[model samples]
Target: MPTTALQDQLERGVAALGLALPAGAVQRLLDYRALLERWNAAYNLTAVRDPAEQVTRHLLDSLAILPYVQGDTLADLGTGPGLPGIPLAIAAPGRQVLLVDSNGKKVRFLREAIRALKLEGVQAVQSRVEDVPGQFDCITARAFASLADMLAWGGRLLAPRGVWLAMKGQAPDEELPGVPAGFAVRAVHALAVPGLAARRHLVVLGRDTA
Candidate 1:
């Protein structure tokens, strides 16, 4: 599909999801998609090549969790080319987002996207999830690692009462047993990303108050 048509699809999909995105949010996401396509040609930022597929997989897939995401600060661990982080930041310009990835090339692409998008409260940091500093009220991990490893490496970075939104392709029941201490699965939400048929689930974990 042409870029304009793909963007039109995106606008409709966003509305279908009932997301009241701030002004220019959809356009910025479209801009980010264009940047990803351009950079992927040279830097190989992402495996998804088609712009229309990206609109469904990358843009809508990320936005599907917008309703669950809350708080003022968020961290996107292993955010290669800023999957959900960049889009989330674009949607909620008020929240601060840290896009953390160790790869140099991917981080470079993220930095370029951040600058080109002119996203205010978003930064791409090249650091391992375990080594990144500061605590966030909400943390997002998309196919980064298993539940245990993700929390083991970055659990300390989550605020005392923070929520961890882990995006998974399917129900990760096997990984549930290994959730580290001090955390528990609060909810498992099945995400319905527009135009994509694959099973998508968001595992919501919260600090165990007990």
Candidate 2:
């Protein structure tokens, strides 16, 4: 597909999501996609190969949860190649984003992406989610792990009143029962990503205040 077509697809998808991004965000998004594509050929960072699919599955799919993302700091646990982290950072330049993954190659790609894209306020760390220190106002885990395990590992990183956004393929009804204690399911939002027909859901979890 042509570069223009990819840009058009991304633009349409962004519009469909009802998000008004900051100036130059669109171009940055495209640049990020291009970088991912280039690195993917040799590194196999992501299974999604086609550029068009990258726009739909990677970029737009990540932005679908933008409306619900809150707080000034976000930690993307197990962010392989910075799926939602990089895209979210590009979309919201002001927010501080931390991309965490244990894979050496992926972390290297993330650093390069951050430097190449000049994404200020974004940092990539190579550490297990459970070992990552500090708290974030918002946390995102995309198909990284089950609700039970994710919370069990990285639950401590969520700040008081912070929100955890777990991206899954379907409503995780079975997984709900396994959610660790001290965390409650705030809501489950069905995401409608443009140019893709797969069921996407965002499970919002928060620390139990009661």
Point to the candidate with the largest lDDT.
2
lDDT tens digits, residue span 1-210, model 1: 776898789998998888999988888999899889888899988889988899999999999999989899999999998989999999888889999999999998988888888988889999988799999999999999999999999999989889999999989999999999999999998988988899999999989999
Best by TM-score: 2
The reply for model 2, stretches above 4 Å from the true place, is none
lDDT by residue for model 2 (1-210), tens: 998998889889999999999998999999998998899989999999988999999999999999989999999999999989999998988988999999999999999999999999999999998799999999999999999999999999999989999999988999999998899999999889998899999999999999
**lDDT of each candidate versus the true structure:** 0.92, 0.94
168: Cα error in model 1, Å? 0.3
The TM-score that candidate 1 achieves is 0.98
For candidate 1, the lDDT comes to 0.92
Alpha carbon RMSD to native, model 1: 0.8
